[model samples]
Target chain A: MTERAVCVIGTGLIGGSLMRAAEKAGRAVWGTSASEDTAAEARADGFDVTTDTDDALRRAADADALVVLAVPLPVLPEVLRRVDAVAPEVRLTDAVSVKVAVADAVARYAPRARYVGGHPMAGTSESGWSAGLAELFVDAAWVVAADDGLDLDVWRDVAELAWACGARVVPAAADEHDLAVARVSHLPHLLAAVLAAVGAGGDDALPLALAAGSFADGTRVAGTRPELVLAMCEGNRDALLGAVDDALGRLGAMRGALASTGGLTATVFAGHAGRERWAASRDPKGVKVSLKGRAPLAALRAVGRRGAVVSGWKA
Target chain B: MTERAVCVIGTGLIGGSLMRAAEKAGRAVWGTSASEDTAAEARADGFDVTTDTDDALRRAADADALVVLAVPLPVLPEVLRRVDAVAPEVRLTDAVSVKVAVADAVARYAPRARYVGGHPMAGTSESGWSAGLAELFVDAAWVVAADDGLDLDVWRDVAELAWACGARVVPAAADEHDLAVARVSHLPHLLAAVLAAVGAGGDDALPLALAAGSFADGTRVAGTRPELVLAMCEGNRDALLGAVDDALGRLGAMRGALASTGGLTATVFAGHAGRERWAASRDPKGVKVSLKGRAPLAALRAVGRRGAVVSGWKA
Candidate 1:
């Protein structure tokens, strides 16, 4: 059988990781980088890399070829315009962290192309091609936009690509995806950033120096690129604001309970119970993976677990 | 030189870990558990354990002997009273999360005993004796209360014990330790709890299921024992409240910036810079470790690094 051809634009962390996953899936993969240096690096790394997005899309304009627009949210509209003008026949997808904004951009600028809005739930604080790892998406959930009018074949191919990356595909509408991430992803970033700032507010370095595992783990994400975090938060501003309000209400209630009762009541105990329950409910056995041949460091293991990359679980 | 004898009350996670660390440090250690089952478990696990705290303290009442009170903050006063009546001659210390309250309790009930307040900055979410490890405090900072009127010999002995347990002794006054932990530790706990509660507040399980590494990392502390979290927060009420306000103010400003300017400006960039600077400035070489003999996992390592238990750093 002929392997599927895939093209990824913007060879940053997410895009580069996706290209690596596509290669792992035995697909003919191509990628484009905004910086010539990064493009050269990707080529040196044995990837078909290009400096121009239009030229890259032109190469992927073959029958049934998939074009993944993996740029940041702010640049999505312009890229959509370019794709519409250059290669509207190519089936398109996205890997932006924010979904609704990208979906809107796609509807406005690339209405002629068959598009599937997607977000691969994977990343480290580091960015760019240098930070990309082949095992990044292993056991992670890749969200596919299951909006009305999205072609069934396009959705299936996207799911196949996610599986190729050793990721489980979760189907959600654009709005649902945005809101879910706002609560879980975006809200946590804001909290960590604020916590980091507060820790530094004090003059003596004892607080930071004496910080152990909890503080390190808690503030790790706050060290990510500020511009990227800001863009993701602003792109999903409404959902993020609502999440912040919810969090504030919860914090205020806890403070009130502490003041009035001097202890956490069963009301606050629910958080502990809920978190444990949620943690236990994660089933690593949900994905069925079978290796086609002897693959290097490939596995169906969940993301963040050791040896997950070498587990080599393939659908 | 003969090994320094140490006794630990309340053989839970922290206490059990201390006992294990003391044993590794070549100290003759004894432990007491609140329940017969825990005492039996401790004995079965090769610890010198008993159900009577008073009896255990009486056995360790020799001159220069140290007793570590590792009970929860709410129960600390009662434990101090028992220690005073049974072993007033034993140099007493504690491993509570909050310091000011513990210091106050020691002053009130165990005034005759030479006392020091100590808090080891290490723990996993799991609790009880079963989770104890010999290396739990390795490479971790153990805060020794540097309050006025503390006996010089008592302080030296306590610092010696901290170094024995593969920990770096960080000298901090009661209030300073309380305030620093309030910002870095207690406030983060409240944020995690609220974030967990808010994430679970939504009816859809999708948000909870889709929670990735950042959400999981940020909220890891929320899964800790709720009552313990409450006690820590309430024990350092003033500082935690102040931290809460500071955090809320920072969060509010960020939300307003996103709403008004539609992007993160330099103001928000402080968090990123502060987090990075904090991460980069960590000096693993700050602690100087010297081992008298070959420890089982002996290596020149910083606390929190791999195999820190045998590093055996003395300050």
Candidate 2:
């Protein structure tokens, strides 16, 4: 197989990291930034980058190259338009959060190009080229959203790109990806933002002083670039809103349970069991939450009767 | 001052850690557990523990000793009653989450003892004696709730105990402590629980596989011992409920703001600024969120006028 050339547009944290990962995979990697200063910084950091968007597209117009749109969601349509006009033959992909919108945009503007929508489930509460690390995608889940007319080979290329970055590739449809991420990622980010806002809006600085590991870890993502968070929430508004309602319903049930002694224990136990199972599967290096070996069906039935359901509990 | 002995009434994670910290601080430490198995485990782990509650209280009846009630809130009153009846001469303190309730209980039952309310902000998802570590409380905030009639020496003893464990002692009134922790700690814990429950309750195992660092960190405490989380939430139900309302209101506003292109950015930015300030104040080793060195008043006014009032913004 010939060496694959990878081009990432927008040299921010995700983009810069992808470039570095592609380079580490022995692929020829190039990057483009929205601003001259950012482009210069990326170049200074040993990335082959340019500030000229058109010029960047021209260089990546090769049919064998994978052109990754790494910009935020709101600007994706415009980026797609530019890419389709300048690099129509190149196979396309993205590292954007929301899939449906990107999938739709790619379908409308870049119909000829085989575009695979992807979201790498990895990032820090930091951004810009300076925050990028080559190991950012290690052991992370990279979701590849299937599009209707996309070729199988293009999907395989996206998966290969993710694997090259040490990521586990997860195949999902556009809507399925959105719904799943809304439950796991988007809703949690908004919830963290709300918690941060509440703590920050409290009287005096006592709330801040009392905020410990739980608060720090909970609100960590809320401290990310504000515009970035807003874009993500806005992009996946429908699914996120639905997830918020689902969570609020769960919380309401817990509140009702708290009204009676020992009622809340059922919910807490269910959450513990659920989280332990989920945690065990996701990251072994993370805090190991032990669960006594029990049949999944029995655990599921028990928790289901208790009015809570965990993912792995189901067959 | 003569070396003070410490007696911990429970050999779970918090109690065991307190015992270890006390021992490391050159204090003779003793502990009790409700279960013989747990007591035996504690003993195996080098803890001087007794399964008999009566004998544990009897051994801790020293006038110069500090008796720490490190148990669940549901059984806190019962433990206080036992201590009052068996060890009233001892200076009393507790490692409970809710301060107001514990203070009231101490007043009602252990009035003769020098009772001070202390809450150590430190833990891992794992619990029990085996999970306890001596360094658990290092650099953590230990809130010592102020009482009207508690002796100055008693307060000093609590502070000294926290310092001996390498904790920063934060003096706060009972109601104040409850309110602060409700906004910062309790509310976030429940929110994490809700997120965990939602992820667990999703249709497929895709959400679990796609769960990333944010979800992992956000739900870290959700995997803790179920009964403990229940006790903490139920113990501070009123305050936590109020905080939940506050957070929901903020989330509702953010949801509404998402309808407009730039509206949600205000809330996101406010959250970012608030969390940055809160994070900087809590943990020095934590990531420093730069705020452009502008006057805080201006920053506050800017965000407050934008309709989201972060604590740092509410002058």
DockQ (Cα-based) per candidate? 0.30, 0.32
Model 1 collision count? 10
A186-262, model 1: which lDDT tens digit per residue?
98888888888887777666677667776777888888888888888878988888898887777777667766776
Q: Which stretches of candidate 1 lie over 4 Å from their true place?
A: A1-3, A266-268, A284-315, B1-3, B266-268, B284-315
Docking quality level of the chain pair in candidate 1: acceptable
- Please give the CA lDDT of all the candidate structures: 0.77, 0.75
Q: Please provide, for model 2 over A69-110, each residue's C-alpha lDDT reduced to its tens digit, 9 standing for 90 to 100.
A: 999876777887887788876788999998998888888887
Question: Which residue pairs in model 2 clash with each other?
Answer: A200-B311, A201-B311
Q: State how far residue A266 of model 2 sits from its true place (Å).
A: 4.7
Name the candidate that leads on lDDT.
1
* TM-score of each model, paired residue for residue: 0.87, 0.83
**Tens digits of lDDT, candidate 1, B144-256:** 77665666566667778888888876767778778889888888887777777777767566677678888898888888888777777778887777788888778777777
Best by DockQ: 2
In model 1, pairs of residues that clash are: A297-A309, A297-A310, A298-A310, A298-A311, A298-A312, A299-A311, A299-A312, A299-A313, B139-B303, B139-B304
Expressed as tens digits, the lDDT of each residue in B238-298 for candidate 2 is 7777887787677667666665442567677777887887766744322111123444323
